[model samples]
Target: MPTLSDHEILTELDDRMQMFIRRQEMMFVATGEPHDGHDCTFVTGGPGFVRILGVNRLAWPEFDDVSLSDAIADIRRDPRISLLFVDFARGAIGLHVDGKAKVLDDDAMRRAYRALNLDPSLDLVADRRPMRWITVYVEEAFLSAAGELV
Candidate 1:
């Protein structure tokens, strides 16, 4: 087993980080612009909402809600984004990923997810439906323990 040194930031998702991601149902996303500022939004889904495509890759769908349009727009312009995943149910174990993102339509997301049925959880999108996916190329990843952050 590999041990995480203090204050170390990983460029790829280690086994523990991957496990954490698989259990998380929600994440907070921060997208920024060069001059203006940043927008922080919450993304929610059912089981396995976030798919780990590779060691440094993650994929999550975006529904058709107009409220999310701005986040997509920011990604298009800057591609620099930060994501925070915290599991409060389990003493607030957390993961933070900083990456560049690209927007993909439904078809693209399906192909990337490698399944015809890209389930973004039913109830959340049952009526509105997903419009696109935010594929992130993680540049930095950090893990936070139960009581203290690392």
Candidate 2:
């Protein structure tokens, strides 16, 4: 296993992030918890946007304050996170991202969100609330394909 660098993150996300976000059809997000100290993982894709930056950070556009707060609070306690992309039609890929996560509510990020077409949508067309983005700070990342060691 090798540590993921900032430059490599930029390249990988720029090239392959979209495929995971789009082609995979679904993804699982795992977050850290301060209570039980166990990771909380959930499947999220429908009615949500996955935005990747570099290798470590990920953001979701158009999330409400309630959901955003929950995600941010967990990140504050545990920065480690992992995202899994499963391609039922083909092979599978698991992307492990070990870093910090932050919920950002900034105008610049909002603009970028719009530019990237990662805006919040209620029905994939209607503009939604908050328009926040979850920024993941990457410490390490590993990619494993099917039948390979993860």
Candidate 3:
């Protein structure tokens, strides 16, 4: 298969692709580290609005969301990270994104938080505060072969 271009990646994320991602409940995020590792988190959100929360200055979401400090440090150390999404349904397509990610906590992030009703934990609390959000700047993305589907 031919490698996809930046434009192609965005096109794949159109309405249909977003639906595919949301329909599934989980995805895998592989971050760069000294030993290179993978973290799987419930996709707690849909496209255009993914979230990760924290306390103090560290951002950790559901034990899976990589710490902002760690992620940023990783980016500085190595900006190569890949996110893998697979659909369990039949004839399902798989999406793989190789990109650089950064933590975003600006006005845009605040707005995103308002639209979401998420809890790092299942229990609801009267007073809860979030830490930060990880904004993935997708660089390369594409579909995997059918054989690769699981």
Candidate 4:
């Protein structure tokens, strides 16, 4: 058996990975604090809801109705987070992204929203317009195709 190191996992998003992320409509987010139990939630949106901000950064909007207080609180205390995206319909593959996440303020949220340049033709649900944004600074990314992590 081979051990995996941080260097072995991809830190930047490649073209194919970016496409995979953009096409997925849902993602599972996991967060935990040092002494507290972990929380996992599923967030769904239009096809391109999550956007890649940079090679090592990604941001996703949080709608008003969704309760992310637990996750947000955990992140504030301990920034560690993991996001999982699976191609259920097409490729049947999954990607695991581990990073530090921060809840962005109004200004930052607006900026991130605008940066996405979403298509006007797409009818985004009125209520889903992002009350806030969570930006993840990616540290390590593992692809299922490479191998299982545990």
lDDT of 2 by residue, 1-150 (tens): 233452233213434544455544356567768575544445455523555554445665534545345555677777666666665554555655556667666576766556555434532435555455567666655555534322
What lDDT does the true structure give each of the candidates? Answer: 0.80, 0.54, 0.49, 0.76
Give the clash count for each candidate.
0, 2, 0, 0
- Which of the two, 2 or 4, has more TM-score? 4
Q: Which stretches of candidate 2 lie over 4 Å from their true place?
A: 1-14, 46-48, 65-70, 106-108, 111-118, 121-125, 146-150
Write one digit per residue (lDDT tens) for candidate 1, span 61-84. Answer: 777757667888899899999999
Which residue pairs collide in model 1, if any? none
Model 3: lDDT to the true structure: 0.49
**Best-to-worst ranking by TM-score:** 1, 4, 2, 3
User: Candidate 3's residue-wise lDDT over 37-129, tens digit each?
Assistant: 533333443332333231111112322244334555665566666677776564656777666666554445557556555543431222443
Q: Which has the better lDDT: candidate 2, or candidate 3?
A: 2
- Top TM-score hit: 1
TM-score of each: 0.83, 0.62, 0.54, 0.81
lDDT of 1 at 100: 96
* Residue 76 accuracy (lDDT) in model 4: 92
By lDDT: ranked, best first: 1, 4, 2, 3
